[model samples]
Target: MKFILGLGKILTIAFWGVVLFNQLLPQPVPFNLLINAVGVTVLGLHILEVLFFNASLRGRSHRWFDRLQILLTGIFHVMSIPRQPQLPRNG
Candidate 1:
């Protein structure tokens, strides 16, 4: 699972790189708007992910950097954060 998440982070970073490079190329890339739209949509969703996972992010040593990684890598980053232990309910 860790390996998968690591691979996902690498792929996501590559996608971001392509999206950025596509903007700079003088020649029109095929599916240019599609790529741009997907990039924007993913970024927006990642921002929401940051908000949704706000509680998990509060106490970490590198909170801001973690949030930035969450912004870039989305769920791939989120999955890496250690989950808080659940308390037992005494009925």
Candidate 2:
């Protein structure tokens, strides 16, 4: 499970990295849509992992806040999808 948790963290970082990179670099609409889809799916899986696997949060104080923070971060990443067209290929 630790490996799974670690993978989740890495994926979480990657989702945000793509978002910021896309912000800095121009990308196409379809690419943006694909990013959004993959990011949202990762976010959902992370949330499920935290909610179902992290038993510490179930009966502890501030549990809601911790989960909320994760949820909010996921939402932010999901909403930050890029909107510009990608650079065209040149011959």
Candidate 3:
């Protein structure tokens, strides 16, 4: 699982690299438009993930760094974070 998540992070970074690099091409290809659209869409989804998981990030160390990673890697970064164990309540 850890390896898979690491692989995912690498792939995500590579994808973003492609998206940014695609924008700099001298002669535009038809697929460039499609790539741009997909890149923007994925960025939106990553932002949504950060919003939805904001509560979980409270009190965590390096919270800002985690948020950045979440933006870059999306669910892959989220899955890699270890969950805090729940404390039992004395009812």
Candidate 4:
């Protein structure tokens, strides 16, 4: 799973790079729209992952950076941060 997430991060960065390069060309490319659409979807998923799974980091002093890392690396960053242990519930 970590490997897959790492692959996703690389793909996301490459996709955005292609999108930006397409934008700078003299003529709009036929596949640019499709690439942009996929890029947006991937970006949205990353943002949502940070919002939901990584909410605990929001209270930290370097939260902005944490959020950014979550957005870029997804669960890979989440895995690196130490999580609090869950307390037992009494009946």
Candidate 4 lDDT over residue span 2-24, tens digit each: 67767766876676677677668
Q: What ranges in model 4 sit over 4 Å off?
A: 1-8, 26-28
lDDT of 2 at 27: 76
The collision pairs in model 4 are none
**Clash totals for all models, in order?**
0, 3, 0, 0
Each candidate structure's TM-score, on Cα atoms with residue i matched to residue i, is 0.88, 0.45, 0.91, 0.64
- The TM-score obtained by model 1 is 0.88
* lDDT tens digits, residue span 2-89, model 1: 9999999999999999989878872365578888889999999999999999888877899999999999999999998988787899
Error of 2 at 28 (Å): 0.4
- Please list the residue runs of candidate 3 whose C-alpha ends up more than 4 Å from where it truly belongs after superposition: none
Ranking by lDDT: 3, 1, 4, 2
Say which candidate scores most in TM-score: 3
The lDDT of model 1 is 0.91
C-alpha lDDT of candidate 4 relative to the true structure: 0.74
Cα error, residue 47 of model 4, in Å, equals 2.0
Deviation (Å) of 80 in candidate 2: 28
lDDT score at residue 6, model 2, on the 0-100 scale: 54
lDDT of 3 by residue, 1-91 (tens): 9999999999999999989888787227778888899899999999999999988998699899999999999999999999988899998
Name every residue pair that clashes in candidate 3: none
User: What's model 3's lDDT at 63?
Assistant: 93
After superposition, the stretches of candidate 2 with alpha carbons farther than 4 Å from their true spots are 1-12, 23-26, 57-91
> What is every candidate's alpha-carbon RMSD to the true fold?
1.8, 19.2, 1.5, 3.1
